[model samples]
Target: MNAKQIIVTKNSEEKEFYSEDKLRASLRSCGATNNQIDVIISQINAHIYNGITTNDIYKKAFSILKKFDRTFASRYSLKRALFELGPTGYPFERLISALLKEKGFKTKVGVVLQGHCVTHEVDVLAEKDGIAYAIECKFHSDSRATSNVKVPLYINSRFLDVQKHWNGNSNNGTHLKQGWLVTNTRFTKDAVDYGKCIGLTLLSWDYPKGNGIKTNIDSYGLYPVTALTTLTKKEKQQLITRDVILLKELYYNIQVLQNLNISANRIRQTKNEMGKLLHYDTFTNGTR
Candidate 1:
């Protein structure tokens, strides 16, 4: 059958004719060379069938990409890495707080703050320059999970409750600045519309086009440990459990690997990957 005639299924259960152009563009964006792109496209053509899932295609492409470079494979698998963050959202919440800290914001995770009506537990509360941002993190283990209008509506109401009391405060005039709804998945149109209608900042995997978490992580160069292709799923979980969420954290404290029983060679390999990702190890090159 012609590859163009193949129907592909998405995690959302949506079906469409497979587009080689789209797949090529995605791989190209991840720094796959033209030759590599040709190889993946040809393999995909040979591998795909009607009703094959997008997830299968992703895995196939990532398998090929990993053989080329772990860094590229890691970038290509970033979205899936996010899913690895959990069925439990605590690691994700701490991740958000860590990213906020990178931007010079003091952050607290799983904070309980008093609202005007009742108390509320914030996933992440970030403060910088007298501005406090309350963030609600919606994490989904399922790829198709999405935040709908109700999410923003719920957060807006809570923000109002907290904002009222915050503005009435007399302690150095520290007040709530913004309320944000962040998710590792996409947001429904209704969710995005309502969030903007009520002035709630929404961050999703690809929402706001280029300013979402995916773009932000690439821009900031602070990838999650889950994105390290050199690390196995179990190893990544171990690092996350040890509060070593970011590659920078792992790079700075290579000794933590000792506690995991990682071998000396494996430690060196892991450090090399982390150094490439975090721009470290110039001293070893005699360039420092």
Candidate 2:
């Protein structure tokens, strides 16, 4: 059965909902392994109940995955569920926009680029210090590094895409400068290099621990992936503390954007500098 046809929906609260059984059937038909199915089911059971709609089911599922759990939560599966949950991509868009705004960057959503009259949905269009940045939030599993080549490629191509928007009839160019790839998983070497070659920056986190502790480090604080690795009892507790601090900081930053008034040109400049800072090489790695 195709993925679409597999899901059975009912209208509830004036919205469509999908049954757990239907979700499982669709995942299975999509070639999900038994283990993946179990992990998904466990997430469902954790929050499953009567009156749960399809969107509710996925929201719960992705929530369970926000932490980087080594067992059961496949990043690939979580990513699939996320995109599948929204045709225009809601939670994902809001999450990215919220993250950027916290950094004091001004933002715009769903920018329209001319040519083919194609409307490309951007998660967050950020501006700071006379520069603009396009942030694409890709929440995919590690497996998608191979299964979904387009994820990285799209990140690589965003520069040209954005440039076209600037150069298009509108001439909104101003300080339009760079792009960012924000993902829950690490990028492949090629993807990283590609970003560097074209001056885009890729930011990803190590898997979080079962308790939802992020590990890797970046401007965003503890990488969400680190939240879920094996650690001594004390270490685990420490990890949670770190995640809390990071989250608090994130919240504080986003709050700052609510009152700020900035132009798109400044945001463009900020994004360009961010791209360079993220890609600057370490002497040992022989990259710069």
Candidate 3:
């Protein structure tokens, strides 16, 4: 049976699944080797069934990839793992801010700045190289949801207001400010069009091709802590609630697990799994 004829997407949209060539292309983009991609595709093909959602396909592929190479699996799992960052998006915002920080931008999250029209609470305010950016992070728990035109419309308006009344900061010498809308999921066509038309930067999953959020995450090796399969959902939530957002943080601070009442054995397992997933020695050396 043809693969496309068998699968349905998570959106309940029926479409032909791509051939192995397309799947190989995707895995390659995530840094998977040719051999690993072939193995993964073979495994997925063996499990193919009618009406399998794309999400299920990805999960199965990621599970197999994890057993082979945890780092690649972690990178491949970036998109779906982002949903695990929140019941609320506080952790998501922090993760974005941290990513910006990695690029030499100083960041502050959840700041209330007074605009000419009204008070606006910015999700993230970043400054670097004499420029300031007012970033709005829209996070969706459901990977299927897209950030729509209304989001950029409202955010751009607020940025205009802030720009109008903005005072130059002598300390940073920042005379220019830009508005950026970032989401863990993809954006609607209308949203992307409006953002481009108005010069607002839109960053989302797989929209801008090479420079999308996934690329940035992979470039910086900043996989979220939630991407680790070793941790349970409750354990993940406990870490997120405490502001431990990145895998590096969790790896170095393994003692934090004790505070959550995780057993010594479980902590050891968590450390071992994280070491594999992140390709670092969680016990011998630290990332910092």
What are the Cα lDDT values of the candidates?
0.86, 0.48, 0.81
Query: Which of candidates 1 and 3 is the stronger one according to lDDT?
Result: 1
lDDT string for model 1 (1-288, tens) is: 999899999988999999999999889877789999999899989978999999899999999998987777888888888899886899888778877887899999998888888999999989898889999999999988889998899988998898888888787346688899999998999999998887899999888997888887877776889998877799999988888888777777888888888899988877777676665663674121
- What digit string (tens of lDDT, one per residue) describes model 3 on residues 1-288? 876566555553756655667778878876788888888988888888877777788888888877876667767777778998877988889888989998999999999887777888989999988788999999999866888899999999999887666653344457447999999988889999999999999998776889888888777767888877767878888888888989778877878999998899988877776776556765568442
| Local error of candidate 3 at residue 8 (angstroms) | 3.1
User: What TM-score against the true fold does each predicted structure earn?
Assistant: 0.94, 0.40, 0.89
For all predictions, the C-alpha RMSD in Å is 1.9, 16.2, 2.5
lDDT-wise, the better of 1 and 2 is 1
Global Cα lDDT for candidate 1: 0.86
What overall lDDT, based on C-alpha atoms, would model 3 receive against the true structure?
0.81
For candidate 2, write residues 1-288 as lDDT tens digits: 323333323322443334557667655643457776778777666655545555566555545443433222332233332333232343445546655675788887666543233456666788898787777776543223421345667654655665665655355645667877776545666776666677776665442232111222334432221122222234323423433222233232332222233344543332232223233332333133
Best by lDDT: 1
Q: List runs of model 3 lying over 4 Å from the truth.
A: 4-7, 12-14, 168-173, 276-284
